[model samples]
Target chain A: MTEEIIIAGFGGQGVLSMGKILAYSGIMQDQEVAWMPSYGPEMRGGTANVTVILSDMRISSPILQEFDTAIILNQQSMDKFEKMLKPGGVLIYDPNGITRPPQRTDISIYQVEAVEEATRLKNAKTFNMIVLGAFLKVKPIVKLENVTKGLEKSLPQRHHHLIPMNKDALTRGMELVKQIR
Target chain B: MADYKLMKGNEAIAEAAIRCGCDAYFGYPITPQSEVLETLMARKPWDETGMIVLQAESEVAAINMVYGGAGCGKKVMTSSSSPGISLKQEGISYIAGAELPCLIVNVVRGGPGLGTIQPAQSDYFQSVKGGGHGDYRLIVLAPASVQEMYDFVNLGFELAFKYRNPALILSDGVIGQMMEKVQLGSYKPRLTNEEIVARYGSWATTGKTHDRPRNIITSLDLDPYRQEQFNLKLQKKYREIEEKEVRFEKIACDDAEYLLVAYGSASRICQKAVDLAREKGIKVGLLRPITLFPYPTKAIREMLGQVKGILAVEMSAGQMVEDVRLAVDGKVKVEHFGRMGGVIATPNEVVAALEEKIIKG
Candidate 1:
């Protein structure tokens, strides 16, 4: 099975890093993964995004016009990418930041207050991890354990201590998703 | 050896350079190519592999650093986009004149001036026709994917050292910024400095000694015959390169008629057109040149004897089409379809041009 996702938001929203973490997790799980960032001058502050494809087979093209899922952290991103989702696709958005829901009726939508949830964990930047945790709960493309292993392998030795905190955040997000569902 | 890992094109180039045992890397930051510097910096090649990585003040300084490292018989490289590469022509010409072995990468963007930082193949003529002054040619390798980006970095160094000439990795912003599954290859280290000095030190400018005559690396020759001899040597080397280094991909060109000739980013778009034409039974194929300098003239000329017409597709305003026409020598019709000034030609536009030029004809 192949899954393509686009993580989009403002420049400082950690959108690119979130995609990179997903790609690293896929690689650790023995799946083919590609992470392509929006390059050139367009990535300064105006809608920075990354396209990630995780597949059991080989990936042909890294440029994807349609996505299986879209994780939007802001309303602008939600508005820009809402129409490009595939039929029966999944969309994960931040309810606190985006007030308006997507107009499409063919896809499943999950609205999580990621910023609020992460702030409850005392780290607002862990909002990306909350989204990742929610993504793992719904999709099950990669095992949650594999993602933790990936985090350990991908990060430097000095930052290894953050793994437990990220794991805890991920578990809390999974629980939050279950509660919301 | 064939294991694959997902990597960006710029990161793949850096990894490939390290695998090729690149001795030194000096470059400035530019869009579409900053990842090349970032990857090198993150990897800390200096501490790991004893490779030197330096961030120069500008493109001019970086290329001159290449000149310095290459003068000392060390494997060196520097990368930039179009405008930055334009600033490096002086140093490139100097490197060419000195007959130094160095690799230069041009992650091309739209240009004539400080154009937008988007993918464009408009640097075709500037790269292949000698962007700098004087009679010179660099071995140019055009990579279409991340895998080729990894492979060509090693091949570039090999070609540069084998011929004592400079080499270029000509890539566009699409290939640079895009990510693909790249199989990381085993690191093949080059010869040590001591070994290179012992082998080619007779001519390399290390130092003047009492037992040996002084070595000069200047290109200035006052006598006309000396300059002519230099030109002849360059021509001979180029001929050898053309005979051995011309690389092109022929897709479904063995049977039936119409052909599409493209390279770089345009080649990927033309592949879609070819596939669509096949579905309609138009029998269209693609001929993509991987080496722009060698031009793949023989392959194009061979196809001219079989195909009805060939459409030259590019991001520039028909720069490479001139070479195609010259190669075909008016044997078969060679038409051009291109978009200039940072515009990309869509598959529909290319197919429409093909229909008007060949299918309907």
Candidate 2:
């Protein structure tokens, strides 16, 4: 199985980290994975994106033009990535900042009020995790247990205490996801 | 070997250098390659392994420091990107001229000038060819995966010491920045000064021992005849490296009609293109040169009759392809496809180029 995914948003929105955690989870499950970020100028608080490819076999190119899934967290990302999604592909986005929603009819579009939910949960850091949760809920390519282990692997030992909050955010995202036709 | 850990390629190189007994790292930070120094500083190899990690004032100073440390028979290394590497060329030539065994890592970015901080294989010419003005050769290792990024640090040092020549880990921005599961190697202790003398005493500058003449390290030869002799000696050593050190990875080539020749980051994209072309019933293979200087010339020559056409894919505007063409020598169709200035070519694009330029043509 293979999942080519793009997660794009503002720099501080944990876009790169979300991709990293997913890639880490893929490794935890014994899958070959690559997490390639848009480096250099784009990372200076502007649009930041990472292409994460998970496969049972060896991953070839970490860079790709099209992806099976586009996890967008901002309007700019939505605008840039909405057309690059494969037909009948999965598009998951946070509705808080996105103005022009995904208008593709052939592809499956899902909405997660991840920012609002994270605010309600009193943890802004969980915002990406919530979106990640929505992604896992739809894709389920990786098990939730592996995601927790992924967090343990990605996050430093001192920050391990926050894994539970991130888990909760992920779960809330799973519950609040709405598919838009 | 240690268990698998998800790590960036730059971090893998730093970790590998520490584990592989890299005695000193003198480097100046450059974009897309600063993580090497960042990781080393965080690990504080000095406190743990007694490895000297210094942030030099500039790339020129850093490479010169490498030359100085290497002259003492220490396993020293310095890392940089495209522009930074250009500054180090003079010192690299000096090290090569002196036959000082050292490792230089070029996590290459776009070039010509401070072009861009993104990944590009444009430095292939500067790396595999003599970027420094000399007739010297560096055994260049092109690591496509993060594991190789880790593996090559140890391998580069081994080869450098083995050949009494400089070794280069020719990496790019993609491999420098991407994260992958890397199986770390176990730690190897640094060689002591006594051990250095005992092992490399014939040519190393460990100190003047009564047993033999003083080991002097210098690249200067004012006498033109003596310089010519030295140059001829270096050429002989380069020929030896070419004979024994050529390394490459061939995928799906046994039954292929067309071949894709690439190295380092460009090879990764070609691998995917090979698969995609196979799906479309195209017999496309991938040949990845791991050792760029000691190039797999004989191997590509062996594929002369088996492969009908070759497309040398690169992240630059055709640098390594020149070497491939020279290897094939007009035996079969040879062409180049490249994406430069940090623009990465996708698998489909490569396949399309192969079909358009090689197969359809």
Judged by TM-score, which candidate is best? 2
Each prediction's RMSD to truth = 3.4, 1.2
Docking class of 2: medium
Over 4 Å off, model 1: A29-31, A40-42, A56-58, A86-89, A106-108, A136-138, A143-145, A168-181, B1-6, B186-193, B197-201, B208-212, B251-258, B269-284, B305-309, B330-361
List candidate 2 segments past 4 Å from native: none
lDDT of 2 by residue, B1-361 (tens): 2357999999999999999998999999998899999999999999999999999999999999999999989999999999999999999999999999999999998878999888899988788889998888889999999999999999999999998999999999999999999988788999998887677656777777787877789999899999999999999999999999989999999898999999988899888889899999999889899999899999999999899899999998998889999999988999999988888898999989998999889
| Global Cα lDDT for candidate 1 | 0.84
Interface CA RMSD of each prediction in angstroms:
3.5, 2.1
Residue by residue across A22-129, what tens digits does model 2's lDDT show? 998998889999999998888998999999999999888887878899999889999999999989899998888667888889999899998898788888998998
Q: What is the per-residue lDDT of model 1 for residues B1-361, given as tens digits with 9 covering 90 to 100?
A: 2456667789999998888889999999998889999999999988877899999999999999999889888889999999999999999999998899999999998888998787788898888999999989999998878888989999999899888899999998878987766788787666675678786666666667677898787767889998999989999999999999999998778785998999876887787677667887888888999999888998998887689999999888788999999999998888889887666677768889999976676
Please report the candidate that would top DockQ against the real structure.
2
What pairs collide in candidate 1?
Answer: none
Chain B TM (all candidates): 0.96, 0.98
What fraction of native interface contacts is shared by candidate 1? Answer: 0.38
